[model samples]
Target: MTTAARYATFGVREAHGVSPAYERLALAVAQDDEVLALLEALPPAKRQPNLLFSVVRLLGGPVEEPAAFHDYVVANWPAIEPEMRTRWTQTNEPGRCAVLLPVLAALPQPLALLEVGASAGLCLYPDRYAYRYGEHLLGAGEPVLDCVATGVPLPDRRPEVVWRAGLDLNPLDVTDPADVAWLDALIWPEHTHRRARLRAAAAMVAADPPLLVRGDVVDDLPALAAQAPADATLVVFHSSVLYLVPEPRRDAFAELVRGLPGHWVANETPEVLGCDGLPEPPSEAQHNVLALDGKPLAWTRGHGQALSWFG
Candidate 1:
């Protein structure tokens, strides 16, 4: 696709799959040269759909209209350049807690959870957040998540997460003010609910942080897997993370999981794993396909707002 076409497609997809506010901004950026020029200023490698939106939000630009947003970008170009150069698109969405609740509840209790690509380790504390799936309510805490469920019965009890650790290429510490602020900046502008939840989750994590190690997930899985206690069920998982892994390495990571002694759970694009028995995800929008041990389980919204269980 041409540059304009790519941006347009991104805008439409984000509108359908992400947020309507981002959709407007993306569409505007596609048509306005001045706005598009600001995006072009970033490194080609950094020109992701989320990058532009994240930068604009970080700079406190309005979410609507291309021209005014363009002026803001131009006015703040000097200040924004350094941030764009150093920051990556890393959103620590705790809303995904809702999507993982059912899967965790179904898993063997007292699990030693290992999450690859766990940014800020917000997802590590599934038991710490409350969830509502239809009429059934689970967890009792400050950060409550509501999800729509289908196809399978919601698990009645929370998984006993005995131990949890996370692996990330760049792990953010929830206790660090700057790190936490960046995570907030990555959130889309109109997602006030999400932003609020992120703050609550960060506070919870700050009070009791999980073990987050920085390393290449594929290269470090075996060692980390070994560190998990043998008495507990090792539940290796990841959400929206493998897209960053190159094809060969992703395959290697899958092979490593297959060789491990416990369950492997993943929420990523269906094609990322190239596993069998998984149907093609709906092409209308981006969906995170949830799977366990290579078998497709369900489809979920990007940030876990809803779940359609196939298992």
Candidate 2:
């Protein structure tokens, strides 16, 4: 798809209903030839709506008004371009833990989780947070994640996570003010609740950080996986991450992770992992297919707002 079309698609498919501000800005950017031309100068990946908008927000540029946004970008392209090129759309949303909770709880006790694209490793502490699946509640703590779940056996308890680690090309440190600011910037402008949640989850992680490794997901995964205790169930997992990787690398990672012992949970766009036989997502809105051991189990909303079980 063309850069303009990608922006338009993101406005319709992602930002619509989710963030009206982003939707309007994205649609405006799609139509603005001047802005599109400026974006075209960057690499294709760097032209993403999320990356562009986040960079602008991070730099204290305007995003609420399209005319002001365009003027700011044009004037500040030098500053914005470098940030867009270096920084990624690492939306480390801990709410996604709600979608994985049911699967993790069903698995054997004492799981050793190794997240593939663990931005800040905020998700590594699923057991440390509470969950609300409709009226059914599990665990008890701050950052209570609520999800609209169907056909899912609401987990009776949180998974026993004895060992939690993560592998990322660029692992974010929750304690670092700058890293934490980028995380907060990635969130949509309208999501006040999510911003609060990010702060809460950040505090939880900073208090007792997990073992985070800066390495390639495909090449460095096995070494980290080996570090998990032999007695615990080693469950390799990732959410909304693999899509950033090239198709070939994603396939290689999938093949390698499947060969590892214990469960493999993937929550990504169906096309990203090429998980076949997935039922049509319950809604026309985009969703990530939640799969366990390569079996498509449910369709999950991005940022873990809801889940629809295939069973």
Count of steric clashes across candidates, in order: 0, 0
Q: What tens digits encode model 2's per-residue C-alpha lDDT throughout 171-253?
A: 99998999999998999998999999999999999999999999998999999999999999999999988878988898899
What does candidate 1's lDDT look like per residue over 160-246, in tens digits?
888999998889998898898789888877788888899999999999999998988888878888999999889899988887677
Per-residue lDDT value at 175 in model 2: 89
Q: List the residue pairs that clash in candidate 2.
A: none
| Candidate 2 vs. true structure, TM-score | 0.98
Q: Which parts of model 2 have CA positions greater than 4 angstroms off? A: none
lDDT per model vs. reference: 0.80, 0.92
Per lDDT, the best of the predicted structures is 2
Positional deviation of residue 137's Cα in model 1 after best superposition, in angstroms: 0.7
Model 1 misplacement above 4 A: 1-3, 33-45, 275-283
Instruction: Name the TM-score of candidate 1.
Output: 0.91
